[model samples]
Target: MGVFSTTSRYSLAFLVMMNLCLKAMASESDIDFSFKNFGKVEPHLALYGDAEVNNHSSSIQISGSTNFSAGRLIFRKPINLVGANPRTMVSFSTYFAFSISGENGDGLAFVVLPVEFPLNIFDGGSMGLLRDRKIKFLAVELDTYMDKTYNDVNNNHVGLDIETPVSVKVGNLSSVNLVLNNGEKLQCWIDYEASGKRIEVRVSKFGETKPVDPLLFYYPLDLSQMWGDEKNGVFVGFVSSNGNSSQKISIHSWSFKSRMPPPRWMHSEPLDPDNVVEIKGEEGIRSIPKRSDCTSRVVLALVFGAGCGVIVAFFIVFVWIVVGSKRPVAPEELAGKGNEFEYKKFGEERAIKDGDGNGEK
Candidate 1:
């Protein structure tokens, strides 16, 4: 029994430690980042449609009077999906080269979605490029119109995005940096139109350009692999949609190419397990969540110790009363009534109590 108890104690301790490790890992997986934007122009996009990359210039200007719930303008180019995921982490910062001809209700959106190679147009800003894998590169939208579909509080708010299950807001404005690097990071900022007077924004691929600020991302990439298909390349372009209230936005230029990012990590499938949650810092920085660790251990020790102490105290009191108190002089009816009570005695305490009562002064 002693040996068994010893093994059980250690086993329980190990299990608790393992549970802590698992919880830490699960929390780590939940850390993510996203972005924000301002409505400078209506939402628009470029559908690589039948446009010949060799024949046409890479950019196009969309012109229209804005007074509709929404509309789409697409400028498409054919490109590649380099890494493991045809999808790449996309970040966009939008600017209005010129202002809205009318401003009561006007907004703009930037998008990267797949379109049928010829040309694909659905209800502008409605399908939001529905189910069109070719035209839908995960998109960033600046919207001014509110529909029941978006559940917007009003047309003034901005949002971060997700397509399949639902679309939700992330940040609000005219100028914002929107980033999506998988689920772990989705960050954004929307520039207030009031502040638009003195604003400048830039977008580049940390692709070919060396970024002063580096971004680490994972893509369906093949560094040294061979590729045979030309259409398989990535396509990126600008898009806009206008509401019944018209707005025009001009994009000066945009660029894309690959650049070396900071060292990053990926756990291979069926990965070897020790601690799956990642924590990075200065080389010598403490590697744990200090306050959390301290509080958790303190709380756990108090809980376990308090619980065990209460139980042990109760057991001791029970045993002491059994051994230290007159054992009820064995109630006459229960005395020796069962095998376990076979040696029980009758009531001496009752007789003593009756005598004492009669003699009370």
Candidate 2:
């Protein structure tokens, strides 16, 4: 029964260790995908209203050349905004190539909205969103038509919107000698860093190198608060609408990638005791080591393995000394040949003597 209990305990420990390993692996849920040309049809895509695949151009027509047309092209799966730990927010970078070929229109936007966002709330000037007070979303708008209701900067500009159509920050493309509705393909990049709580946007003509400086940079925007405890996560998509029949918004290609970084301590190294400095009473100060001093996971693993090996070796030596000290000693009379007993006292050496007297050797 005791042996069975010991085996069961070992099995339980193994199972628990395996469960922890699986959870660690599962926490690394990253999303990475790229769409080149979008093919002749939408793959793993969801379209609503006037959104469709343009087989001739091998692109996604976000809004058709029709008056008051609104549409959305969303990836089917939701991207996690909050990490598995719920405290860390996921950081992401997305790039898309699009073109607007028309005389006049409202514009389109790349949006992140709740998973249960209503699909029917799309309008031309609203950029496929409604003016409801309850809806919450984040968007990067490429406006080609100025609307007074939303206080648009101009007909050719980029804006970052939080919750409402009204932008908190706007960037005029004319300053950079770029036109939004010039019927030319353009590329846009949006990056968010969870560590800095910052988001940046960049735009350039298609096939051009990415800009060194971002067109717009917003900080202190905690995206984790945007979802309001919506466990299902957020949906990422392109929203577009046209106010005139001649307006057309087409997306040539798109790609998205996201990462959920581990806790800061996981990337840190054990501090050296000798390097620790005693803090004085607000007088002298010294700079600590940089974060680059932290070792990688490989080095940490090797160190941990070495520590465990030392502990196991010490335990083996300890057991050997304990058992050896407790061994029974043979009687002096029974210490002859074939006595089947041989023991040495600790801290003493045994000397054998010859059979004759005074022949000690």
Pick the lDDT winner.
2
Tens-digit lDDT track for model 1 on 1-361?
A: 5445555565577679869996674433122221122223223333331211111322223323334433344433343323333222212233222122234333444443343423354344442244334232333443444555667544433443443313443333323343221111122222211111111123222223333432222222222222223334434444444444444433333333322121112112222224233466776433443555557558877887888799789656754554554333666888656754433333566677889999995
How well does model 2 score by local distance difference test?
A: 0.80
* Model 1 RMSD vs true structure: 23.2
User: Could you tell me every candidate's TM-score relative to the true structure?
Assistant: 0.36, 0.68
Output the number of the TM-score-best candidate. 2
RMSD of 2: 11.3
Residue 50 in model 2: lDDT: 89
- How accurate locally, in lDDT, is each candidate? 0.37, 0.80
Which TM-score value belongs to model 1? 0.36
For model 2, what is the alpha-carbon lDDT of residue 75?
90
